[model samples]
Target: MINTYPLLRPLLFSMDPEAAHDFSFAQLDRLERCGLLSRFIDKPLIKPVHVCGIAFRNPVGLAAGLDKDGKHIDALATLGFGFLEIGTVTPKAQSGNPKPRMFRLPEANALINRMGFNNDGVDACVERVRRSRFYQEGGVIGLNIGKNASTTLEDANQDYVMCMKAVYPVASYITANISSPNTKNLRDLQGETLLRQLLSALHQARIALSDQYGVRKPLFLKIAPDLQANDFKFIADLLLEFEIDAVIATNTTISRVDVATLPHGNEAGGLSGSPVLNSSNQAIHHLFQSLQNRVPIIGVGGIQSGNDVRQKIDAGASLVQLYTGLIYKGPQLIRDCVRVFN
Candidate 1:
């Protein structure tokens, strides 16, 4: 599989980034459906570990935004992730930003995406998860929830609450995605007062959903990598105050300093891949220091190699996730990370 990716790379690179993304997933799904995925994809063989009370086969897992609707879980599951997270699924379906929203910087091994939470809505996503053989086979699935673009900041809680309830019954964990830079004012939810309000609402909703379903689902907050010292401290404190299960320290960064001179570096969206590693590690280091082991951190952003994955763990990430790295390095990256734990 690793050897083949080098050959497949040119064809994928020639296509529009988003189109390539969709086509690749479709082909993976077809291969999986035909039972040929296992012939090429290596299954991860790391010792299982627990994070946020859920068991994971390995620490390497897929990040959200790649499979926005939970439609490709079964196929993606074949790629050897310890756990699979899908969506940034909004309460309702949305078309998301505009065309040419996802760009590739081959030289830097990076991507700039402002593809705002485009999906087939929470209900549709929930249905897809419910029907997934991988999900039913006990694959750990985390549902990442976000508010629709049309939903105002003031009403964000309702959107999260609605999506939470719908996904709670099926998800191993739920992520509040208030950190994506693409959504208008979405990052503002990270402000002290609003974050407390939003988390309080989500906490109450989680309790209700737990009672109704007889299963307690863990809740994680996905935050931006561009936070300052004060902002990071405040968020760590809020996570403790609200009893949030964990924090995915560092979503894509709004900073373009590292890639400013590269093509599409100045694009108005979150920058991900190699350039984001430093900022993400800094945020993880801050959160790990501030929370002082009270809250666990899932490190994401710019992880492209096993050394990069190890650096994140050494920086205090309990578990790590990858998106852009997978695109650049291919499925063997998962094997490489799993080997780190071994």
Candidate 2:
């Protein structure tokens, strides 16, 4: 089928970034319900990959945030992703940062958003996943969890533990999201002492949850790209020490070096898309060097094409994910990246 996103792009681009996001998903859900979505998008290419003990139909998976609440899994699943990760969910629901928080930079193929961890909360997300056909059909799903905005830094571990227990049963894997710049002082968790404390708590929680559910779900950590050079090795060492299953290298960046001159360039929040590709790759490369293939790396941040996917793999990513790229390149990008693996 010929790609129609190019034709539809102009229309979506005409609306506010957040509104366009909602409108697109609303329309996607409608198309899916009417059984018309398949006609417009091709099935994802099959290139099986086994990572962290999970069998993925393809390495091209949807990153978290796009379906933060897990409400669009079935519709998104139809687009042919090998897997889908939902959430950055907290223990309680939140309205997130104020409106006009998300922005698009077409010239740089980038997006700046301070959406925060806005969602229906972990319990609601869990219930939605339980009701989704995709989950029932055994689709691989990763649930990314985080702390509530009101939670104190000292009490953050409790929030993460709460979310982990809530999602453990339904998650093929669980990611501890400590990287979003939108969340006030969230990145502080990435520091050595706090990260160790957080990981230790999560490790113990996973053990209990595994025994309770009779399944040992893998735990992945999502980190930021704005870290000091030595931080990568430090983080890698901690990953090894805690037996964390995998690491998602470099979440949205706080740096504006690349898109600093473009519109919305100075927007505070994570900067993702083409502008983030290089730094993300650098982070992946650093992690790979420190990890020495001991822990798998899921590369994400600005991947926009098949070659971009290859860059991640070549840099030592066992798997890769997409979010901002989807906004710029559409569903065809998934097929394009999957074909590369084949």
Candidate 3:
């Protein structure tokens, strides 16, 4: 696989990032269709991830961006992720921001994407999830839902609430994505007043939905990696206020502030890869420190190797996720990290 990745990577790299993703998944789909996925790729890819009231088979999860609409869940699962998170889905399907949207920073082993929240919508993702052979049958699948970019901050609660209400039935847990910097004014919703209101509304919706579904699935909030201590404090307080089940320490960082020496460091979009590793780790430590272990965390960003995975676990993350790391390290990284977890 290592020998083949170099050959395959460059071919996919030549295409646009978003297109490359579609192409790769399409290949996975075809491989699944051919029944060759498990025969070749599935050699003990999952361990077990017990966090936030969900039992994921492993700590290595495919981060949200790679399969945003849950379109390739089963195919992706066959590659051996212990868990999968689909969507940054909005209440409504959206085209998101325009293109040359996803940028690659090869030197830094990172990706900068302003793909916004392009998805087939929460209801659509839910329908796909419902039919899915993974999440539907109790394999671990988390849904990360976000507000439609056009929604106002004041009305954002309605969008989030709508998404939670729609996807709640199909998710092991629901993630609220308020951090992606690409969405205009979306991060503004993370401020004290707006953040609190949104959480309050989401929690109320969660309770009503849990009553409706007769199951208790956790509700987690995914936050930005680029924030000051005070910002983390306020957000942490809000998590406590809402009694949110867990906190995903980061989505991605907009601060090119950290990787000044890397090529394309000035790129406009959130940066996720090696450069933001420390930032996300520190954020995780802060959350653990601030919450006093009151909440479990799913660490993301710059996770490229088994050591990185162990660092996140040692830093108090119950589970860790990756996107750029998988891009840089290939599929063996997942198996390797699971070995470390064992």
Instruction: Give each prediction's root-mean-square deviation over alpha carbons.
Output: 0.9, 0.8, 1.6
Superposition error at 201 for model 1 (Å): 0.3
* TM per candidate: 0.98, 0.99, 0.96
Q: What tens digits encode model 2's per-residue C-alpha lDDT throughout 143-259?
A: 999999999999999999999999988999999999999899999999999999999999999989889888899999999988888999889999999999999987999888988
What would the per-residue lDDT of candidate 1 be over residues 1-342, giving only the tens digit for each residue? 345887899999999999999999999999999999889987557679988889898888999989999889998888889888899998889999989899998888999999999898999999999999988898999999999999999999999999998899899999999999999999999999999999999999988888998888999999998888778888988999889999997899888888889888898898999999999999999999999999999999888988998989999999999999999989888888878875
Which runs of model 2 end up more than 4 angstroms from their true locations? Answer: none
Candidate 1 least-lDDT 10 residues = 38-47
What local lDDT score does residue 59 receive in model 2, on the 0 to 100 scale?
90
Which residue pairs in model 3 clash with each other? 47-57, 48-57
Candidate 3, residue 62: how far the Cα is off, in Å: 1.4
lDDT: which candidate is best? 2
Sorting all predicted structures by lDDT, with the top scorer first, yields 2, 1, 3
- C-alpha lDDT score of every prediction, in listed order: 0.91, 0.93, 0.84
